[model samples]
Target: MRAWRFHEPGNIANLVLEEVDTPPLNIGEALVRLECAALNPADRYLVQGQYPRAGAPPFTPGRDGAGTVVEVGPDSRFTPGDKVCLLGGGLTGVSLPGTLAEYAPLPEAWLAPIPDAWTFEQAATTLTSLTAWRALEICGGLQSNDTVLVTGASGGVGVAAVFLAKALGARIVALSRSAEKRKNLIALGADAAIDTESSTLEKEVRAAAGDQPISLVIENLGGPYLEKSVRMVAPEGRIMVIGLLADLTATVTIGLLIHKNIRIQGMSVNNFKAKEAQDAWTKIVDLYNANHHRPPISQVFPFAQVQEAFAHLQAGPMGKVLVRCSA
Candidate 1:
């Protein structure tokens, strides 16, 4: 099988397509004939060797994929030809060969049934949506009527956060650098959209919330925004930090945090265990099937053009970029 492997991660150029032997399914695992693979920021980080996961060189770089079961171990519950999407396996682009190939071995526990309403492209993007859902619903303890702010609101995770927050009946304020993207956010059920580039995001959020401080902040960008996030959070509000796309090194004022009684947390999609991850994936699938929301597909790439798909994600987009792996 052909897979995109990192020869010695330094840049995107290090990702090379090579033919390798297909991995066999182990006990409790199944071999999936991948239909689509979703590219995440972590994929780029792994390819560039920026992530903390240690691995030998020439690893395939993808975390989430949707596919059909081609073979299953005798111990697994799934049979051949079941449509599924994989969750946490720690095999994408870092610790092991990932979904960047035509096939991948996934644990049965990590597989979620794709909703009948969703296409392979949508299912491939479910992991990020599940992460965002867990961040706001489970970890953040979001409640209906609470005002939530989502940073990086045009990106994959950000868009998911917006939709999930809305689905849970929370009032959402989406922050983005682009005006056009802000318009899209409003269409996605955001109460309001703030332009983080031109206006003071802290001020805009305060104005939108209107005497009510932001109840929860789903943050992806750090740097200056962190300081502002700390300030704008309501007393007893929770701030979930998921990604650092802006600046990682920034001085924060501890006094504000002390006075505001804010709870700031770092959230990663990989932090959840098997049972929790499986539950979250099921909830997302149910939501999609119920017509509550859907994952947005910004673009779809052929399996042969996985590199181009990664490049498109790096350029930034309104939703997840998908790479179709099945003929």
Candidate 2:
């Protein structure tokens, strides 16, 4: 099998494509012939040896992908030719063989059947949608008619958050620096879109909020933006931290939390229980089938252009980037 193997990751250039032995199918696991794999910002961090699991190299690198089962191990629930999508490989390409290759062995628990109406590219992008759903529902506790603020609203999780928030009958104020992307967010059901580049982000958000304060904030950018989000939340409003695009460490005024009684929760798909993940998947698939949500694909690169795909994601794509693992 040919895979994008990390030798000693310092950059994407260090990820060399070479023939590697296929992983042996173990009990409770199934072998999937990948059709498409989506790249996340986490992949970039893994390449830079910034991710915790990005220790020793010589492993394949990818986390989320969609494929068909080619072989199922003993006790596995999947059957050959079953279409499936998976979310975690615990830092794949870092600690384990990942979806960047033509095939991967995934634990049955992590595999979810893909809908017939969805394409492989769409299935590959489901992890972000699931993350968004989990963030809004489980972490943020968003309710109908709730006004939610979504930062980094142009990215995969952000866009999905907008769509899911709309589907739940929640009002959304999406934030993005690009004016064009802000327009796109509005088209995707954002009640209002604020340009993050504006010096008066708080003013714009407050203006959009009118009287009712933000009931929930889906924060993607951490660091200083988190402080702003903390300030924007209504009294006792929850803020869900999904990603730290700016800085890992953040500083916020302690007085704000004490005064407003804000609730801050970190949202990670890895931390979700099986039932929670299943619930999220069900909602995402139903939304897709209802034409209420669609995974935005910014670009699709061939398997050979895996490096380019990583580079594109690192440059901050407006939507999801995918690698075509097979024809």
Candidate 3:
């Protein structure tokens, strides 16, 4: 088998294609022949040794993908030729050999059957949507009619958050730096789109929400947004932190917690309860089937051009970038 491997994690340049033996299937695991792999910011962070959850070096790098099951171990529900997509902790390429290769062994529990309406490229994006589902349903405790604010609303998780929140009947206020990208947010069902680069972000949000204070804040950027989120949330409101694209460090007003009874939480897609994961997976598929959610695909690179795909991911495209792993 041919797969991309990192001898030692330092930078993207360390990634190289090499011939390797097929990974043996463990109990409750299945061997998947990958058709499409999604490149995420975590992949870049893992290669740079910046992600906290990634494992030691000498592993393949990819978090999510869709493929056909080539073989299934004992006690697994999957069968040969079953179409599935992956979820869970082994998603980090540094810890386990992921979908960046032609084939990889994935836990049977982490694999979900792809919906009929979705292509492999579309199924490759399921993990991000699942993360959004967990953040809103479990971490943020979002309710219908609640006013929700999403930072970095143009990115993959951000866009998914906007769509999922809207489908749940929440009033969404989306924040993005680009005016053009804000249009994408509005199209994704955000009631109001605020330009984050604008000096009057706080005022704009206040005006958008009117009498309603923000009940939930879905923050994908950590730095400045984290600090501002503390001030904007309503009494007893929840703030879910999911990404760290901006600055990792945040300075928050401690008084806000005491005065408003706010709750701030950090969410990792890798850490999800079995029932919660199943519910989220079902919801996302239902939403997709209803035409309520559409995961954007900005670029598709061939497997041989893996380096170019990583470079493009670092360049910060508005939508998901994918690698077609098989012929």
Tens digit of per-residue lDDT, candidate 3, span 69-106: 99987777988999988764344364777888999888
TM-score of each: 0.95, 0.94, 0.94
Clashing pairs in 3: none
lDDT of candidate model 1 versus the reference: 0.82
RMSD of each: 1.6, 1.7, 1.8
| TM-score (C-alpha) between model 1 and the true structure | 0.95
lDDT of 1 by residue, 55-144 (tens): 678688788888999998776788888998878434554586688899988777778887777777788886678779878988999899
Name the candidate, 1 or 2, with the larger TM-score value.
1
Candidates by lDDT, descending order: 2, 3, 1
Give Cα-based local distance difference scores for all models: 0.82, 0.84, 0.83
- Distance from true location, Cα of 61 in model 1, Å: 1.3
lDDT of 2 by residue, 1-327 (tens): 888887776876888888888889877788999999988887778877887756467777788899999999776777899999886533344466778999998877778998777788888986688788888887777789689999998987898899988888899999998889899889989999998768899988989988877989999888889999998888888999989998898998889998999988887766766666767787778877787456888899999998888778767677789999985
Which model is ahead, 2 or 3, in terms of TM-score? 2
Candidate 2 regions exceeding 4 Å error are: 88-94
